[model samples]
Target: MEAINISYRAMIILYALITVPVLICFFLKLGNVKQILIAVLRMTVQLAAMGLYLDFLFRFNNVWVNFGWVILMIAIANITVNRNSGLRTARMFLTVMLGLTISAFFVIVIFIFIAIRPEPFYDARYLIPISGMVIGNCMRANTIALERFYASIKKNEREFLTYLLMGATLREAALPYIRESVKSALAPHLATLATLGLVSLPGMMTGQILGGSTPIVAIKYQIGIMIAIFTAITVTTVLNLLLSLKVAFNEYSILKRDIFRN
Candidate 1:
């Protein structure tokens, strides 16, 4: 039941497989051949570098190193969420990080630590990947929520202002947009969760199976991770948007124009 290693030659063949799409893009004048190649090259370089560092980290397996790496990932994710969501980076950085940290506490402490309890508790192989999954999904959800919330209020400023003028509190006026953004951010994850096994074998389950876990065991882990991801994304997105109301608005409840980078 041991997994077979992929040889370097197999990797080279995989890289070569991209040539078909590269040629098609070239002939179609897609003008994205360079972009495609750059993306692939970046993916290759990043994963390769990560592979080396992960090997080092795994070998050493210090508790501090593992937790520090998770913190770094969250910090990076926080910044990206701020920048992409059009929230002023300096203004939203600490707020975003706090939201992310809180969400991480829920996922890692409750699910990973209490439920799974992988040996050594700080095992990088388990902690790092699970942290990455939780943090990464939270980043995406936060970006969507913030962007939609702010953009909606900005685009419908008159409507928002009218709501406030009608004696509605700031929270009441903002509730509509907040609900919309949360719904928008959560829709895809919901659909994916619904169709998980029916549509396709989830990547984590597939990887675990390939790594020689029994199919039933892999499914259990997959279910746990999916629940972790969905919950993390929901809590992070809602918390971020709620906190953002303070950071993104003026005392009079106006969306700050200067907060957007673009």
Candidate 2:
């Protein structure tokens, strides 16, 4: 069965629902009604624009065009990760971009080629959405990992230095912080995975079901996507931190304060 479309009137009603929260915020003097309205407006405009662009992309479906869009997504995600992680964009851009691109494409290749294998192998429909999901997760995970890792070292500089002075190698000194950062980055996803179906339905599975796929098919796709997301996040987070070592620190094994955006 084809999914039902939402008419403009229906969509307007849905948008009207935002006022519920806005009213609550105003009554409580929370002072974020304006922010909420702006956020809703931005989301509406961005999704509308994206819908149009995605329509064109699906029709064009050229391999070069598809890969180009994926690259653009990766670039945007890379910039966002750096900005949110409080890292100087220019300093970590290339390294983090490399990590994200590698991990995202690695998982996408396996997921699309081996698992789904859509006809034409590079079908924009399958490739683009999967890439977006994987890259998006990588962006968030990398942000947490990078932010926590650097912040930990900066906050515990004396302790970090003590590890170094007491015969620890650079990697050895950074190991504890790395472990903590990776764990912090992965924890939310792990919890989500554990509570997935019991707590709430995931977007992919719900979308697939609404789009007319069998429940079994939707569940399988959701499982595949979740695995892909987790793998991409883990690889990108660790690879980003490891590759960044060359630029994040000096030859003398000192963490560079200048790398931070502040």
Report the C-alpha lDDT of model 2 over 135-249, residue by residue, as the tens digit: 9999999999999999999999999999999999898999999999999999999999999999967999999999999999999999999999999999999999999888998
lDDT per residue (tens digit) for residues 1-262 in model 1: 8789989999899999999999999999999999999999999999999999899989999999999999999999988988888777888888888899999879999777899898999998899888998899999998899889988999999999999999988889999998999999999899999999999669999999999999999999899999999999899888888887788889999888888887
Q: What shift in Å separates residue 169 of candidate 1 from its native position after superposition?
A: 2.4
Segments in model 2 whose C-alpha atoms lie over 4 Å from true places? none
Scored by Cα lDDT, where does model 2 land?
0.95
In the order shown, the candidates' Cα RMSDs to the true structure are: 1.2, 0.8
State the RMSD for candidate 1.
1.2
CA lDDT of each prediction against the hidden true structure: 0.90, 0.95
Checking candidate 1 for backbone clashes, the offending pairs are none
Considering every candidate listed, which one attains the maximal TM-score?
Answer: 2
Could you tell me every candidate's TM-score relative to the true structure? Answer: 0.96, 0.98
Give, for candidate 1, the lowest lDDT window spanning 10 residues: 240-249
